[model samples]
Target: MVGAEESGRLVTVGRRFEVVRNRPLLTLAVGHMTVDMYAGLLPMMYPLLAGKFALDLKTVGMVALAYGAGSSLSQPLFGWLADRHGTRYIGLALSWTAITFALLGFVPNFAVLVALAALSGIGSGAYHPMGALNASAVISEARRNSAMSIYTTGGTLGIATGPLIGVLTLGAFGLHGTIFMLIPGLLIAVVLLFEMRAIALRPRRTGGSPRLVPPPVPIGPISVVVGVMMLRAWSVFGLQAFIPIWYASMGYEPSFYGLLATTLVLANVIGAIGAGHLADRFGRRILIVGSTILSVPALLLFAQFPGSIAFVTAAAIGLLAASTTPLLLVTAQQLMVGRAGMASGLVLGLGFVMGAIGVPILGAVGDAHGIQNAMRLLALIAAASASVAAFLPSEELVRQFANRNSNALPAASLPTASS
Candidate 1:
């Protein structure tokens, strides 16, 4: 949609930039709300399902693991597809996600449930690339940090809301019925795919000859940034998985723990936006280093106590932890140049998969030692990620990306044809 209009002497780019930037935000909000709606209540589901199936904690955790596994596996493929085929491929993926996740609700058998969970994860795998690519399209080189922050916040909001929706739906419709909540949200995301399809590929139409084939993946500072992100994901996931249990063990009531989870997410939302703005104005390294340093004290303090102070500390932890995700995402996007889809997958997929692995490992340590003892490593890892981030060649990386690709705004950064 980023058409340039020619006067007798001057050429003006149309509002395509705004449309590209804003549309994805709208779509991502819908996508994440549905995903968050599911996430918010995911914890509450395990015990109920375990009872219905007569399963143990280990087995139930596997179900969650399988979901993560599904999400992790398809990332490389979807990322590849998204890059080669452009954002249009997300249409197939969105519809597939809605249908699979909705149908997953109908399966009662344990084995079937496992399979469905994997399928749902696959669907989720599709959503991330499109959202990341869309955000990348709208963000100018200068404002990518800000754009990613806003885009990633939608996800935080979704994650924040999911458990609440599950809990509320639990009382209203029971565990089986909560799937109804997710169905509409998935459908909405599927519908939004049409809008994206209607918007032609921006890179192709920017008065430059379109390269149908994406170039080989760049390997340098981009690789370094992604590795650091993967390491940090381990700690983030470990904390997200076990914090509530730790809080409950410390004598916090279930309802309060629930509220605390939501608070952490809410704080994360604030952190994401703030970090993005900060990254835009200051620079990525400063945001990453500052956020990580703040998180260490917050996580340690929360682990140290129980009650309002602990919850407050946990909220601070979330603020620091969640804020880093968007910064990481945008940085990866900037580094990868033409591989926006692949870059998103590498950052999010690998980081999250590492997080999935971290949960059980942390659980094992908590089982043999203690939860608090195990979490010290999490603090250390966060420190490392931040330290590693400070050294990443961000300015040089952006320059490298610009050296490789067309010097025009991507579809994510442009307005629609109608505009």
Candidate 2:
């Protein structure tokens, strides 16, 4: 009876460890989705809010800027902190995100609204690097790309759902309905706290936590990768900025605009999920460059054509152009293995900041020439980004170098004669 009981105990123990290993990514992914839903909430509600406050377009843009600055600009600091310490506050960050967004409905004026938006942004920013770092840590390098893709898909889907959720809830209950948003955030926070504890307590295979020590990656190659990401961000932000306005100007209904937005984001989600698998199977570089190159023609189709063909081309652009994001993220992480948190932040945070900056600039260009011309410029920028992507070393080369360094570690750590 004692032996049988011991065997059963062992089986239970094994199952628990398995759950500990795998469940955090799933939890963080859900957390990511829940928090990012708020990111889209403000934009969706902007029309209603503008009417309520009698604000102009420029004033509305300020609210977005406030949110963008808080959420994006502060990512590097949060990421660095996550790397230096750990993801202890990830749950707190997400919970705060919920609180802030829920309060957005109650703000008395534009200033308070901007402040809450910033707080919401900060909350959103705090989770990303920490969640991404934790996700990478939870999986082996071989499966990292696929795992990250799965993780990212959750957030992308969340953002896509945000607009629909906003329209339904706000339309029904007005601004005060945001109070209902608290439920999901609170639920996810509890899940994250419990799961993160379990993962933390799970025994490390190496018998110790791996301390953050800088890895050696060439500055030139990584710089090129960062540049490519920034350029891609510009195009992404530009499309997102102009698509609705362009459609409205052409006399399309709100429903049509929503469809376009949905198609683009859903296509992006599909691309993000699929591209990761392709990156793992084929080389990362090929998928990155090929996708970017293909997206240009889709943009051209979008520009040159009209009607249903434009919608099809928009989906194509989304599928091909935006699909490479996960691949870029994985590449950055690989290049800086020890600093995965920082890499994630740089790719996500910094890239988005550049995109935000491009919005006004693109608007200016649109004013001077035309919105269509501005979009053409975006296509050109994407092509230029692809050209930059060509500079990245082959995947095999990076992997071989990493393997060589790993193999030499034992020798390097061996005790000297004096010791």
Error of 2 at 269 (Å): 1.6
Q: Given candidate 2, what's the lDDT at residue 141?
A: 69
Clashes in each model (backbone N, CA, C under 3 Å)?
A: 18, 0
lDDT of 2 by residue, 107-137 (tens): 9998899888888888888888888777766
In model 2, the Cα lDDT at residue 419 comes to 6
Q: State model 1's lDDT.
A: 0.66
RMSD of each: 6.1, 7.3
**Superposed Cα deviation of residue 112, candidate 2 (Å):** 3.2
Model 2 scores a TM of 0.83
- N/CA/C clash count, model 2: 0
Worst 10 residues of 2 by lDDT: 410-419
In model 1, the worst 10-residue window by lDDT is: 8-17
Please tell me which predicted candidate would have the highest lDDT against the true structure. 2
